[model samples]
Target chain A: MSPQHRALATREAILRAAAEEFDRLGYDAAPLSAILERSGVTKGAFYFHFPSKEALASAIVQVQDDTWPRLTGQWRDRGLDPLRTLIGLFEEAVSLLSRDVVLRAGVRLAADRDVGYPGLSSAHLRWEKVLGDLLLAARDAGQLRPGVDPEAAARTLTSAALGARLISSATCRCADFPERMREVWRLVLPGLATDEWCPPALEVLAAPQEP
Target chain B: MSPQHRALATREAILRAAAEEFDRLGYDAAPLSAILERSGVTKGAFYFHFPSKEALASAIVQVQDDTWPRLTGQWRDRGLDPLRTLIGLFEEAVSLLSRDVVLRAGVRLAADRDVGYPGLSSAHLRWEKVLGDLLLAARDAGQLRPGVDPEAAARTLTSAALGARLISSATCRCADFPERMREVWRLVLPGLATDEWCPPALEVLAAPQEP
Candidate 1:
């Protein structure tokens, strides 16, 4: 491999190590030495790629942020209904969070107080906007019930999803996240969707495959 | 004051200071020196009362736990409907969390990653049981719908409340916690309660006074 290709590979290895460290031990408790050991990279290579722990954490957040558009774009390309598309996005997240150390670490780092990252709230705001826009679109398409405020629904749903994820992580190591989210939708959709949309929404939630 | 009374006061003061420190700086970053400075107590006196920061955090959790029974007892004594009483209990918590630094501090400490206090999960378990019992009563009293499972509802509501409180604290310093909770109940109640209970439940939520 070219020297540049090797450099990129080393950078990716360092980030993966940092993400796992943050996910397992949290930001404050996770040490740079452990990350270096986990990555099997010397301190020189590590610092050459990422200067500080904060920089490594920020890169994780950035990488996590980059995934959102790609995930959502895939659903949008499928031409599914807006609400189904939203559920699809979250389902994708749940799957990623369950298996992907980098994404899980990104979430942990975002919420870690000692890390001092503001990305968590911004991420919430972005998701709220995305969900709100989708709900509005569903309403426009006569999918949502009349008089249901899309913004309020979006805010509540976002909060509920976040709460569910946290509780799942704490109580069950997120083993039941997809199931918990299904319960959230079961309770929330009735108030948001018209009768005609309920069946398909449930179908989307129940189906194992991506839309 | 008697010497015993003075000691008790000193202990209380130290706990308060520790709680505030943990709440503001989080567990990993909060220093014992800052706690001592905040309490205006000597290091010796602080150590005399609480052996360590972990002990101080445990004491704060204990104090927060003690408040729950007293608050719930007050609602139970009023002979209010079960659903209303449940709402009252949470309403009381919101009020305390708003004005009481110690309670807010306890919550922040419980959620803090570096703290690692199992008391937090136990507290959640306790609340879930309390809520589950209340929800079962509400179901029996015909306040809740016939098919709803009280245990599941209780778990969801507990998780949702925790999530909402976290979001509120981070986003608004919990200035809007009551309003945020109101929205939670607004969305959750329709699924849990019968139609007849809706109006009264809404009224219970709207009332500023403790029921």
Candidate 2:
């Protein structure tokens, strides 16, 4: 491998190992030695790539951005029906909750006081705007209720998705998580649509997919 | 003073002192010696009232329950108007958030992983049931719209409240917290309410209360 390629691989390995450790033990309890051992990288290589544990944590926060877009970015702007796009996003997230232990642990770890992860806050700002823009488009298309507040709906919907994820982690079971989330969307979407429209296959929306 | 009267006063003082210390420095960081000094009670007196720091922390948690009841516990059985009750509860919580520093800090401490505070799980359980019961009552009363799942809504609402509180603490300027929370309520309530019911005063419900 080229020197640059080898360096990139080492960096990725370090972040992957750090993500798991931080998730399992939180930022405060995670030891640098353990991360080093897990990644099979020297202290020199680790410091060459990242200066401190907090820096590694900051990288994990960035990794989530890449992860989601990789998994579901294609759904966005794919010219699919907007409702379908939204349902697809929820399905993908629920799938990750059940299938991706690292991602799941990363999320719960973000809630810890010490981590101070800004990953979700950044995601919230961008996603809320995207959702708001979509809802506004649907409103102009005469597909949504006249009085629906797109920004507010977007905010609530985002919180609902997150709320489901939180519960899924706490219960250690996603058996009820997807269905419960769909129920929230079912209630929300009808109230949002102009003619009290209900999505035909709410069950499909609740179907779990492999991450 | 009677022996019983003296013991009660001393216990209350220790709880107050410990809460202040815990609120300031967090559960793990706050020292028992500091609490004793602040309360001006002997170490023997403190031990007599509470067996361990965990016991003292539990007392602090009890103090939290004692404070919020008049402000929040009133949401139960205030008639069948879910939208109104929902609005009322959010408004009350917001009002409390603005005024209650110790309660706010204590909750943040409870959520902290580094503290390992044991009272948080129990407090969350109590909160979940209370909120769930209220939502269930609303659904039964037909105030909530058809297909609106009470359990999901309750969980979502609780998460939203938690996220909002955490955000407010991090941002340190809650001037808009209540308004934002009201927007959450506004977005969800119409979906949850029956057709016959239009929310009584959405603007009023969203507005901050008079001092």
Candidate 3:
């Protein structure tokens, strides 16, 4: 392999190691030495890639931020209704959280205040904005109930989703995330969507998806 | 003051100090020395009341556990409808969380996993049971809509409340806790309650109480 290709590979390996450590033992408790050992990379290579633990964590958050827009963009391109697209985005997020340790670590780190990563709240703020925009679109399309405020609904839904993920992580290691999210949408949709939109929204939530 | 009263006051002071430290620095970073300095109690006096940090945290959890039942019991004794009683309980919780630093600290510590406090999940489980029972009573009273599962609804509400508290704590130092919780109920009640019960539930949420 070319030198550049090898360099990229080494960086990726370090990020994976850091993510696993952070995921297992939180940001404060995760030791850099353990990450180096797990990656099987020399201390020199580790330093070349990540100067500090915070730097590694920040990189993980960046990757998470990058991944989200791409996933949502794909759903947006599908030309589905705004509400369906919002559900699709959550469905995608559940999959990513379950499949990607780096993403999960990023989320956990973001939720932790002691991490001191400004990027953490930025990520949440971004999601809230995305949800708000979608809800506005849904309202314009007559999919939303008459009295529902898009911004308030967006905040509640976002907070509820974050809360569900935290509970699932603590209680079941997220094995039940999809089911938990399904229940949240089940409880929330009737309140947010117009009567004509409720059946289809429920259908979207009930449709089978890969875990 | 009597000897018993003095001892109780000292114990309470120590718990308050520990909670402040824990709330500011998190569990792993909060040092016993900081708590000691803040409480102005000698090390010997501190140890006499609480043997260890974990022990202290456990005591805080115990205090929090004790507080909830008394608050809920007050509402239950009022002989209000179950749904109204539940709203009153949440309103009381909002006040306790805002007015009581120790309670806030206990909640933050309980949500934290690295604290290694076994009592944390127990606190949450106990709350879930309380909410479940209240929801079941509401269902029987015909307040809840048909096909709503009391256990699942209780879990969702509990998780949502936790999530809202976390968000409020992060965004506004919990200054917005009551407003955030009100928004949560405003969005959730419609889906959970029968149409006839919706206005009364909203009214209960909107009613102001002494904090």
Candidate 1: regions farther than 4 A off: A1-17, A32-56, A76-79, A113-121, A209-211, B1-21, B31-56, B73-79, B113-121, B140-142, B209-211
Residue lDDT tens for model 3, B64-165: 767888988888999998988888898789878877879888777765543421113446667779899999999999999998888888878876776666
**lDDT tens digits, residue span A1-211, model 3:** 9999999999999999998888766677788889999999999998998899889998987787788999989989999999999998988898778778888887767655434211125466678899999999999999998988899888787777766776676666566777877888888888999889999889977788885
Model 1 agreement with the true structure over A1-211: per-residue lDDT tens digits: 9999999999989989998788766677889889999999998999899889889999987787788778878888999888888878888887787667788777767666323312134566677888888888888888888767888777777777777666666666567777777777776676678889877888888777432
lDDT of each: 0.77, 0.65, 0.80
TM-score of chain A of each: 0.86, 0.71, 0.87
lDDT per residue (tens digit) for residues B25-118 in model 2 = 6677888888889999998998999999888887666555676566465765566365566667767766666555556545645554322321
Query: What is the descending DockQ order?
Result: 3, 1, 2
- Looking at model 2, residue B122 earns an lDDT score of 41
Error of 3 at A130 (Å): 2.5
Candidate 3 residue B85 C-alpha distance from true site, Å: 3.0
Model 1 docking category: acceptable
Query: What tens-digit string does per-residue lDDT give for candidate 2 at A41-157?
Result: 999999999999878877776666577766556777587666566667767676665665456545545455332322134455555676777677766766667777777777667
Please state the i-RMS of candidate 1.
Answer: 3.9
Candidate 3 residue pairs in clash (backbone atoms < 3 Å): none
